[model samples]
Target: MASPTPYRDENRRRLRSALVAAARDLTVAHGWPGVTMAAVAKLAGVSRQTVYNEFTDKAGLAEALARHEIEHFVDAVSTRLHEHGGDARAAAHAAVLHTLAEAARNPLIKAVLTSARGGADELLPYLTTRSELVLAAASAAIHDWAAARLTDPDPDRLALAAESVVRLTVSHIVQPSAPAERTATALAEVFTRLLG
Candidate 1:
């Protein structure tokens, strides 16, 4: 006999994903300051209580949304790294370029950066100042990729390189000084040098 536990868990997961998607859409359209729990619930076609159940407050929802978005970004980085195999510069260039290109075109990211210009970016901390989530996730992904591909790489140096690349990449995302291709090419040079 089926206990239905798996089905129940899947249903909960879908509901949570829908709620987050609603929050993302609202944020992209109106920025984080305009997003309300009631609005998210309405957009997701769920009760306000359901939104609160999944996320205790606005901060919780913001954290969840940031984490979800970072997951997508990191997955893209990982894919680019894998696609380039063991060539450190090529991998970094490809990964960073993909990220920069995505940020440039992604409406939600555009909204976040645009909101920051108006001094209303509630989610900027997740990507910068309060960046434990972003740094840890991105740095770990980079370190793991390097460990798997680089031969006899020093652990400490590798870790530092990973964090440095991530910080630099995030800085570029926040404020770009050059085009994606040029910036990625420069960062790739630095990445290889740091790895050595």
Candidate 2:
């Protein structure tokens, strides 16, 4: 069946965004385990039933939050990649530099990495070992972009390179280091060469 009016869709999006925003804030301040549907409902000014109606359950909300975070990073990475024009090296360098900085400070990421500090951080696994959502999304996006930019298309090679970039970069996010800039620069060099 056809959808409803644009207004309805917009309202739906607005409510969903608000709920996610509320959940994120609560999670960051109180930890994932500390957050509940009731708290999200109160913060978002919606009823508890409304939160469940939109998210199904706590796990669903966490998954949505993870997807939102990954998508944001994917968009930023795409923009950074394109900003370098046609220079693969320059694009990779810029993308790497931008990505590492975001990863370090991103609250969603902090929520996961700082699990010991607070909360069960159930969402962390969805980003890391439990699911391949981040890796798959990132690799596919990078592969598509790199394929279009390449003079000679090589599917296997391009896939491997993109996967490497996503996996290695995400690994650093999971464990981190004293300085991410150095890692970003080195990885950018490798990815640049792979694409070049």
Candidate 3:
């Protein structure tokens, strides 16, 4: 079998990106229920068939959008971790602060939270209930940071720290009881204990 041509791969990537972008914008504007495959195709300036070709189905499309956004968040977290170099506490503090602040500002996250105010909740499962992807991705990012700074970091300890940090920060994003700085500081203290 022949390998996919470079032009074919590029076109596929571009089309998938366009579809995901369109779906994300529509989802932000009007809950997931409001976004239809037809609407996504129209917004993407592509045929419905093309959208299906790229994503297979609605579930696939939703997965793609979630992955895109989650990875974007991971990138931000990675950057914040790197900003603190070898200071595990500072890295934890910075990453938590940055992530929570961004979650408050991100349109898709806002959309999901806001949709709870009305009748149906169509878009939150990907983030809240069915959140394995989000948790796993976040845990991986946190583990990477911890592993880089901790002395021969134990896998179990790294996993524990990662899950603790992600779950704590996600709780804050879902419902902020205190300011992020305080939360970050507190979380950093925990990290210092775990990694110290």
Q: Which candidate is the best by lDDT?
A: 1
Candidate 1, residue 34: the lDDT equals 88
Off by over 4 Å in 1: 1-4
TM-score of each: 0.95, 0.89, 0.91
Per-model lDDT: 0.90, 0.80, 0.84
Error of 1 at 128 (Å): 0.8
Q: For model 2, where is the 10-residue window of minimal lDDT? A: 112-121
Off by over 4 Å in 3: none
Per-residue lDDT tens digits for candidate 2, residues 51-71, read 999999998899888888888
Measured by TM-score, the strongest candidate is 1
For 39-76, candidate 3 gives per-residue lDDT tens digits of 99999998898888888888889889989998999899
| Each candidate structure's count of clashing pairs | 0, 0, 0
**Where in model 2 is the C-alpha error above 4 Å?**
116-119
Model 1 lDDT tens row, 24-141:
9999999888899999999999999999999999999999899999999998899899888899999999999999999899888888888888998789888889888889988878
lDDT minimum window of 10 residues, candidate 3: 116-125
